[model samples]
Target: MTLHGRAADAREASHLAIPVGSPILAGAHRWSDDEGVIEYGEWCLPPRMTIGYEYQP
Candidate 1:
């Protein structure tokens, strides 16, 4: 069994995501300081990732 962690919106705000190919999004996940231990079944992203800025060019 795998169990992930979830923080509040305010607390999760600290969590940043690693930039895939953009410098602006570089090291974004470093902002989160209240990160709790997470256990993911598959560390890889899902087939369809949540592209918040998929349209950005």
Candidate 2:
């Protein structure tokens, strides 16, 4: 998984319903099994939104 903060591009801004060059939280992740990647996705959130994750071992 990877996460970053950046200025939203035209496409992202449109989807996020914000103006171009607005700040946004973006991330991409992939899940895999022995054979190959099982799932992959990309997402972005508006500035006011928050996201969290937890891991246990």
Candidate 3:
């Protein structure tokens, strides 16, 4: 998994309901097993939104 902050493009802006070039949080993740990749995805979040994750090991 990887995350970064970048300016929203036109497509991202439209779907996120934010103006183009606005700052946004973007991320992509990949999950794989022995055979091959099981899942992969990319996503963007609005600037004002907050997201968190907790790991227990």
TM-score (all chains, Cα) for each model:
0.17, 0.88, 0.92
Per-residue alpha-carbon lDDT of model 1 for 1-57, expressed as tens digits?
Answer: 232333323222333343333222111122223585443232223222443445556
Would you list the rank order by lDDT, best first?
Answer: 3, 2, 1
Top candidate on lDDT is 3
Candidate 1's C-alpha lDDT? Answer: 0.31
Which scores higher on TM-score, 1 or 2?
2
lDDT by residue for model 2 over 1-57, one digit each (tens)? 898999999999998889999999889999999999999999999898967779899
lDDT of 1 at 20: 36
Error of 1 at 48 (Å): 2.0
lDDT of each: 0.31, 0.93, 0.95
Find the 10 residues in a row with the least total lDDT in model 1.
22-31
The stretch of ten residues in a row with the least summed lDDT in candidate 3 is 44-53
The TM-score that candidate 1 achieves is 0.17
| Model 1: lDDT of residue 26 | 18
Model 2 poorest ten-residue lDDT run: 44-53
Ranking 2 against 3 by lDDT, winner: 3
RMSD of 2: 1.1
